[model samples]
Target chain A: MGDYVFNQRHLLGLADYSAADIRHVLEQTRTFREILERPVPKVPTLRDKTIVNLFYENSTRTRISFELAQRRMGADVVNFSAATSSTKKGESLKDTIRNIGSMKIDMVVVRHESPGAAHFLTKCVPAAIINAGDGAHEHPTQALLDMYSLLVHFGRIEGLRVSIIGDITHSRVVRSNIIGLTKLGAKVTVCGPKTMMPPFVEELGVRVTYDLDEALRDCDAAMALRIQMERQDGALFPSLREYHERFGIRMRHLEQYPDFVILHPGPINRGVELQSEVADHPRALILDQVTNGLAVRMAVLYLLSGGSRV
Target chain B: MPSRLLHADDFDRTIRRFAQQFTEPYDDLSPLAIIGMQTRGVYIAKRIRDRIREFRGVEVPLGVLDITFYRDDFRSLDKVPTAKITEIPFDLDGLDIILVDDVLYTGRTVRAAMEALMSFGRPHRLRFCCMVDRGHRELPISADFVGITVPTYTTERVQVRLAELDGEDGVVVTEGA
Candidate 1:
């Protein structure tokens, strides 16, 4: 296929995409990875295109990653944090986005506190919408990047056993990864406490487990999510020490599986989901995930939004 | 529908003569860098580099440039081509560059190639070279080195096939819409 018929105008969730779509994204990302290795990594593919990062929540990492990806394609970016925006003045999401759309912005990468915020803007504005992360709905780009990191390390994602550890109820990253990784033919097991696990989470097509060690038995990879302290009201579990004892991935826990790689989406809750020692471990693909996250975003943003209209 | 312009023998002889004309004025090709446009241009560049090495007894630095991102007609295409890697391992600043392409019709490919080449760094000098210069002047651009020149109408297409890619080395003229 010489031409890229990615076929989708917006990337809302992985569930909306087919298996071929995900593979196409990963294949195109390989070429972009080569570009990243060159002396001058910047490509003028999207020059003169303006993209607005409309974030309703505080996110230093994802916002910066999307901005860097846009700059690599020579596109201009405007960051709009909710703390400094008119949304704090009680303006509606549509009203603010409609105003932004009036200025001829090409695409809007949105991170909203409510689920379906991206789909909400698709009906209101003419600009292309990319769901950075919506409430606990889906973070398609984050999961796609995680898949990229796994594909790079393991050379294949299909037929591999992957265990997602910790805070499954509140992690949008886990939701997105389950849909993508499963569609790519991976066996996924999500492990968390009863309180942190969402109701009927198995309906999302993954095995449920309360025990992390049991899930890690023969799993090729384990992704450790941060225990979102702010998302949890008081205490989802009995105590932090107890959670660390039962659920946290420590050095002793990893000694059982010799070939498993542990991954964590950053701003880590150091001694909670993973110990500081495990975070710094060589087998952990955490840092590589962060690095590949940029390339994956570039691939998605380029394929979906970097069109002729730009 | 199909007309052979240059077969494998002519292709080899033409590139050999091109190497002579290229290295004649300059005693030192150490400062020269050659880059080919994507797909077919890349294959032709490798063949030319091989011939140059045979004559000069030294390897010339080469790179591959994909101009898919820089094309002006990106939106007008029937299908948007996949983005290929634009790999320039060495820096381009203060180095003379020879850009190779398969066929030249409207000169849009050369225009896009020049824009892509400068993205790495400003070359000291840059020149275009093509295998066939089929005449249909939509833009004021010409190749510094050309293998053959054919004057044709806008309704005809100039297709270049390489043995490494298409299992044969030849040029053809085909009817276009």
Candidate 2:
């Protein structure tokens, strides 16, 4: 109705946020920003709201950021570790969510190692489902923050050239960022090894590339995708060294374009997809991305809750 | 709510007067160095910057800071969170920083903004400017430049809307819960 609600039960994916919706979220983020700046920063925006952080995957930044965002907005936050939950005891994902929903949770922020785990949980609970990270599928909030970071840097998203490098097949950040960036009118290029890069990525209306140098050229921003070793077992690439040599972004590689800004969704492997020098460089917005993660998540919660209020 | 109203010209003149009071001492301050706290502060800062440029042909740099994570009351609230973007193209180190806002009620927002601003860099001087300074100082803070001083009770809320953001320009005082 209101260009799709950023509500209590939002499923985390770029598909969930339309261009207008994204704009609305970003615009609403401004108000949340102001609220955050108050000495007594907690807003009663979600006074009685309860958010269940059902993380099946281990994440330091994502979980903590979401927790902080919720607390900042005046919502009650509950952290559910899947390792100790019924899932470890062989209970179904649906039953777990159902049992939790019975507790009257207003929303669920889920991060699972399996693809579409958040989607699965959505079916089991009426609570607003937000995908933190579901396997290799989508991390919508990560993409939103990335887009927010980029928009803040560039002033506008329309007609900008963005290159996403690394494990396109396994990186959920890539999938979400590609969808979100393209939707906001930015031209995106996915570059990595042929094995790691997804097939028919052009179907998403993005240019596919095996050459990192070619992809890096003339690009306004280059986002290096993290190579999840746990996900790769001789299927994607021959060796990590080979991937680093050809596709990895190093200081030498960055010398080709002095104006390009670099981005990486963290837990970065020093020499795998990106060099430490490039990651730590002033042009790198990786750490800023981490700081922005909290704010953007707060924005998501605010807009979703505010929409529900209307 | 007594239906308080001020004409657009009066608002513009107040802004002009506030701008004069705020910028008078910093005649040599580069226009490219001002930063605004986010939301309404940004709108007020933009107006001051534009008016300064229009009158003196000196365009100043403006940026917005989002202090969501830096606030003290974060843990007492909701867990489903949203974040805003913090955009400052240039460094604020040793530069004059004029933190702008629409209404100064309890001074808590300014305090949080100051905390957030410190993370970027220490400024040469930090000043506070506000559209309305409603008397209810929860902290020992006073605006360097104020457009108006309206005595308000604790149950009253002040709302400011700009044409650039809210499709209109006006201020409203409502009864708070």
The numbered model that scores best in DockQ is: 1
Best by TM-score: 1
DockQ for all models: 0.43, 0.10
lDDT of 2 at B22: 59
Candidate 1's displacement at residue A86, Å, is 1.9
lDDT of 1 by residue, A113-186 (tens): 99999999998877778999999999999999899999999999999999998999998999999999999999
Q: Comparing to the true complex, what docking class would candidate 1 get?
A: acceptable
Write one digit per residue (lDDT tens) for candidate 2, span A1-310: 3334444347568887778778766666665555555445565556667889998889889999999999986799999987777788898777888888989887889998888788787678767778899998999999988888898899998899999998888888988888888988999998988888677889999999889889998899999888887888676777788889999999997787888999888889999988878889999999878877887888777655532311
Candidate 1 Cα lDDT to native: 0.86
Top candidate, metric lDDT:
1
| Model 1 chain A: worst 10 consecutive residues (lDDT sum) | A301-310
Off by over 4 Å in 1: A1-4, A306-310, B19-29, B53-57, B75-80
Q: Global lDDT of each model? A: 0.86, 0.79
Query: What's model 1's lDDT at A245?
Result: 90
The TM-score between candidate 2 and the true structure equals: 0.68
